[model samples]
Target: MTDTSTDRFDFALLQSSNERTERRNRRLLSWLLGLVLLAAASIVALVLYLQTFEREEAERQRVADGQWLERMVRFHLRRLEEDLLALAYHARERQTRQGSVTDLPAPDPLRGGTLYHQPDVLLQHGWVPWDSSAAPMAKALRADAALDPENAAALAVMQDTARGLRRPSYAGPLLDAQGQRTDRLWLSVPLFERGLFVGTYVASLSLDQALKAAVPAWFMQNHRLERVDDQVVWANDETPSPRPRDGSYYAQLELPGTQIALYVDALKTRTPWLPRLFFGVALLFLLGMLGAVLALWRDIVKRQRVERELQAQVALRQAMENAVTTGLRAWDMEGRLLYVNPSFCRLVGYSAQELVGRSAPLPYWPANQSDELELVHRELMAQGTEAQGVEVQFQHRNGYLIDVLVHEAPLRNAEGEALGWMSSVLDISERKRAERLAQQQQEQLESLGRLVVVGEVASTLAHELNQPLGALSGFANGLLNRLQGGRIGLDEMPPVVDRMAKLADKAGRIIQRVNAFARRREMTREPLELRSYLLRVLKPTQRERQVRWQWDLGRIEAWVDADPGLLEHAVRNVSSNAVEWAMRATQGSDRAPTVRVALVRSPQQQSVAEVGISVGDSGPGVSDAQREHIFSAFHSGKEGGMGMGLAICRSVIEAHHGRIEVGIDPVLGGACFILWLPLVAPVTT
Candidate 1:
C-alpha cells in the first residue's frame, strides 16, 4: 500500500512538469503569431497611409499655389484701380479751383502735374497718342481708327458716387460686343473743356500678348489658347482634350484693361482637405494594429499552453514539421550552429560536417539593391524587431540569380543581447514574370481600343457626308441662277438675294461641321461668358430638337474654363441624348417631350463662379443593369448605340478632374445627367 501511494505522488509531479513544458511551448508560439500579425497589419497600413498623405499633400499644394497667384493678380489690378481713382480726384480738384470747365482747361490744369507718356502697353500695341498739352490727342486717336473705335462703350460704364463726401469716379474694362479684336477698357472722370463733359483720359492694355505670357504648365494641358476672334493663338497640350470653350477666368480687376477673363481650367473644384487627415489616421492605425496583434497572440498562447500538457500530441508536432519543408539552421548565443537540418544542407549544396563550426555569414542580396536593403536592416537591428517582405536576387552555387522573397527575424539570448537573424526565402520568378506579361497586355489593349473607336467613327462619318453634299450642290446651283438672271438685279431683288444667301450660309456651315468632324483637333480656349455660352449652346439646339426644353436662364454671367469645340461637342451630345429620349417617351402622348437644361451657379465668388450644367429628360430612367456598366467602353443600352459617346464623355470629364453622374431628376421625374465646372470670370472683354 505504501509503494502504491509513492507511485501516485510521482505521477502527479510528472504531470505538472508536462503541463509546464507544454505551456512554455504554447506561449512561445502564441507570441510569435501575434508578432507576425502585428507586423503585417502595421506594414499594410503604413503603405496606405503614405499614399493617402501624398494625395492630400498634392491637394494642399494646389490651394497654396492658387493663393499665391490670386495675391499677385489682385495687387496688379488694385494698383490700376487706385491710379484711375487718383486721376478722377485730380479732375474734381481742378473743377473746384477753376469753377468752370472752360477756365479749368488751362487755368486750373488739374493742379496735378500733367501726365507724361501713355502707358507702355498702348505704345506696344502702337496706339500711344499723347498731345502737346500732355493729354490724349483727339486728332491722333481719330487718325488711327485702329487705336480704339469702341471708346464710347468703354466710357459708358463710369459711375460717380459719393464716397465719404468725396466724389468717387470709376469705370472698368468694357468688352465691345460688336468688334472682335477692337475694344477699349479704361476711363477717368472727363475733364470738361467748357461746361460740357469733354474727352476723358483713358488707360488701356491689350490682352493679346499678355494672355500668351500667362500660359503655364497646367494651362497647357487639355486645351488650346485662342484669341476672341476664334484665331488659334497658341496650340499645345492638345492630345487628350480641347482647352476650355475659351481660356478665360473672370474677376473684375481694377486694371488698365477691359474686364475680360484671363485664365480658366477645364473643371472647377473646391480645395480638398481629407487626404491629409486620412494619411495621419492610417499611420496611427498601423501602430495600433501592431500592438493589438502582439496582445492577441500573448492571450491566446497563454490560455492554451499554460493550462495543459501538449507534448503527447504527436499530430500537432508532426503538422509543424510538415509545414516547414525548407532547410532550417539555429545558432546559440555563442554564434555556434546548434542544429542544422538535412534540408538546409541540400539548399546550400554543402554537407553539415563542412558547414558546422564555420562562420558562414549570409551574402548581401542583389548588389544593386544593397543600399535599400541595408536601410531596412539598420532599422530592424535598432528595433530588435523586423519588418519583412522585400524582394532580392540571391547568388546560388550554380552562379545564377535566384529570384526570392526574403523574410528575417532577430535572435536573442535570455539576457537579450542580439545574436543574429533567422531567415526564410521563397522563389517567386514565375509570379514576377506573370505580372510583367499582364501589365504589357493591359497597355496594348488600351491602345488598340482607342484606335478601333477612331476607325469606326471614320466609317460612320462617310455615310453622313452624302446629305451635306446634296445640300451644297443645290444651294450653289440656285445662287448661280440668281446671279445670272437680270430679273434678280443686285439692287432690286432683295428677297431672292436673302433666300440664296441663307441657303449658301447653311451649306457653308454644313461644310464647316464636316471639316471639324474629320480631324481630332485640339480644343480652342478663349474668354467666354458662362451665362451667355449656356444660352447660345442651348437655344438653337433645343429649338431644333423635337424635345420640349425647360431652363432657368439666370442673369449672372461667369467666365468659365473650357474648350469651345469640346464644349460644343459634349453639350451637343448630352442635349441630343436628352431630346432623343424625351421624344421616345412621349411618342404617343399629347404632351410634348421635355429636356431640361440648367446652369447652376454659386454666389460665393465675387465674380460669377462655381458653375455647372445639368441635362435631364422626361423619359424612362436608366435601369439598374445599365448604371453599373454605363462608363464601360463599348457598353450600351439602346439597340443601335455604339456606346462610345458616354464612354468618351466620362474620359474627357475625368481628364479635367470633373465627374459626370446620372440620377433621377427629382424636379423632372426622369433621368438627369450633371456636369460641373468652375466659373472664374466671363469672356466678355
Candidate 2:
C-alpha cells in the first residue's frame, strides 16, 4: 500500500508541470502578437492623420488665397474709380475752355508763367488700333469721326461727363471698320462746365494686361474666371463656386464702387475625385482601423509570417492614403505618366482614368511652362533618380493652364535601387495667377497716369518749340533790314554779322535741346568736366523760372565717362525744380528767388572720389512723406508736371557707375537734390 501511494504522487507532479508549461507558452504567444498589432495600428493612425486632416488643411489654404485675391480686386476697382474721377475733372476743364468760342480767357499771371513748360512723354505704339486703349483726346477724336450719328452722340455725352470730373462708366460692343459689332471697346466720360454739359473726352485702358490686374489676383483665386478669347474682363474669382444645375449658367452682379458689370461663371463639372477626396479621408480612417483589427487576428494564426504581412499591409495603406490625399502620381523614365491618383487628376481637371499612364499634358500647364516640364523629365531620366519640387504647368480640358508645385520622390523596389519616380502635385495655380495679375494692373495704372501727363503737355510742347524759332526769325529780319538799308557803314557789318551768328547759334542750340528731349534716349558717356557744365546747364532752366542761381563749387577735376546730354538734362531738370520751389516759398516774389549749389568730396573713399552736386533753395524742404521715394520713378509731389525728370536723372547717374541721392535734410531751409558721381582715378596698379 505504501509503494502505490508514492507512484501516484510522482505521476500527478509530472502532469501539473506539463499543464503549467502550456499556459506560459500561450501567454508569451499572445504578448508577441499584441506588439505586432500595436506597431501596425500606429502606422495606420499616421496614415489617417496625413490623408484626412492634412488634406483639409490644403483645401483651406487654397480657399484663403482665393479670398485674398478677391479683396485685392476690389481694392483695384476702388483705385480705378478715383482715377476716373480725376479724368472727369480734366475733361471738365477742357470743355470749359472749349465752350463759348470767344477768345480764350486770359491766363492767370501766376499760372501762365509755368503753363508752357510742361513736358511730353511718349504714349503708345502705332500698331494699336483706335479704341479705349487710346488717350482721352484720341478717343474723343475717334468718336467725332465715327460713321454712325448715334454712336457719335453717345461718345459726345461721355465727353461731357469727363469734363465734369465724373467717371466714364460705359462698356458695350463697338462696330469696327468691317461693320462687325465687337465687344472690344473703351470708356467715354462726359465733361460738364458749371452745371452746363459741354463735350465728352473719351479715355480707355488696355484690358489685355491692365484689366486683368484691376480685377486683382486675389479675386481671381476667389472667383472662377472663364477667359473668352484669352481675356478676363467678363468674370472673376467667384466664378468657380459650386452650382447645382447640370448645365452652364451665368449670373451678373454689380461691382462695388463700379458701374461695370461683373459676370459669374455658372459652368462647373464635379470632379469624380473631389467628392471622393472629401469623404475618403474619414471613411478610409475607419476602414483602416477595421483592416488593422482583421490583420492582427490573422497574425495570430501564423508566427513569422506576421512581421512581413503586417509591414506590407502598413506600407500599402500608407501609400494609398498619400495617393488619395496629397495628389500622388508616378512617371516612367521616358516622360510618360505611369500612374496618377484622384487628387492629382482633380487638380488638372481630369479623371484618374484619363491621366494615368499618359504623358504630361501641355494644355493643363500654366502659361509658359514647356521648358520646365522638359527639364524635369531630362533630369529624372539622366540620373535614374531625381526628387525636387518645382513649379510646373498643367492643362485643363478647357485649355486653361494650372500652376502647380510638384514634389517628386524616387521609387525603389526591394533591391534598394531607384527605378522611376512618384510625385505629389500641389495646385498653386490660383496663387500664381493672382500675383501675375496684380503686377499687370499696377503697370497699367502707371501707364494710364503717364498717358494723362503726355496728353496735358502736348500744347505746351508745341509752344515751347515755337518760342525759339520766333525769336530767331525776328532777329534775322531786323539784321536783314539793317543791312539792306545801310544803317551805318561797312564797319557796322562785322558786329552785325557777329550778333547774327550768335542769334542763329542760339536757335540751333534750342532746336538741338528740343530734339534731344523729344526722342527716346540711349544714354552715352564720355569724360566731361563738371564745373562749367553745371553752370551752363543751370542758367537755361533757372532763368526760365526767374530764379537767381549761385554756385560755390571749388576748383575740382570731376572728370567722368558719362552721357553728357543726359547729365546736362539732369542738372537742368533738378535746378528748374528747385527754382520752382524757391519761387513758391516767396509766393512767386520777383524779389530774387535764390538757389545755391555746392560741391564737395567725401573723405572716406580715396581711390574713388565722390563728387557731391547739390541744389539748395531758400524754400521749405521736401515733406517727410515725399522724401522716402523722392528719387523713385514717376513719383511727383507737384501738380501739372511729368514727374519723370528726377527719376530719369537718378537712372542716368546710377548707370554711369554713380548715384543720384537725396541730401541729408538740406541744411538752412531748403529742399536739396544731390547727385554723386564716381570720378575716374589714375590707375595705380
Give lDDT tens digits, candidate 1, residues 442-558: 989978876775664553344334444565577567767877874455675566556566656644554454345435445455666756777787787766676666886577665
What clash count goes with each model? 24, 44
Model 2 lDDT tens row, 1-685: 3667655323222221245545765686577557656756765675566567555655555445435444554455445444444544554454356743123342222221111122221111111111234443554446533855544555545444444455444333334556543334345544444676544433343332444644545444444553232122443332333322322222222332223333333233223465456456655655675676566555544433444455556666666765674677787766677887677666677776666667753345555667776676677555533344676667777787667776667777799876688877777867988999999999999788767645434533443335456766776787788878878577766776676677667556544544554443565566667777777777666556666677788875566667776677567667777877788888845566678888867678477777878888877778788878887645678785545567667765676777776653344477877788877653222
Model 1 spans > 4 angstroms off:
1-323, 326-388, 413-422, 434-549, 552-569, 579-594, 599-613, 617-644, 650-685
Where's the lowest-lDDT run of ten residues in candidate 2?
121-130
Return the lDDT, model 1, position 279: 55
Please state the error at residue 346 of candidate 2 in Å. Answer: 3.0
TM-score of each model, paired residue for residue = 0.33, 0.37
**Model 2 lDDT, full chain set:** 0.57
lDDT for every model? 0.54, 0.57
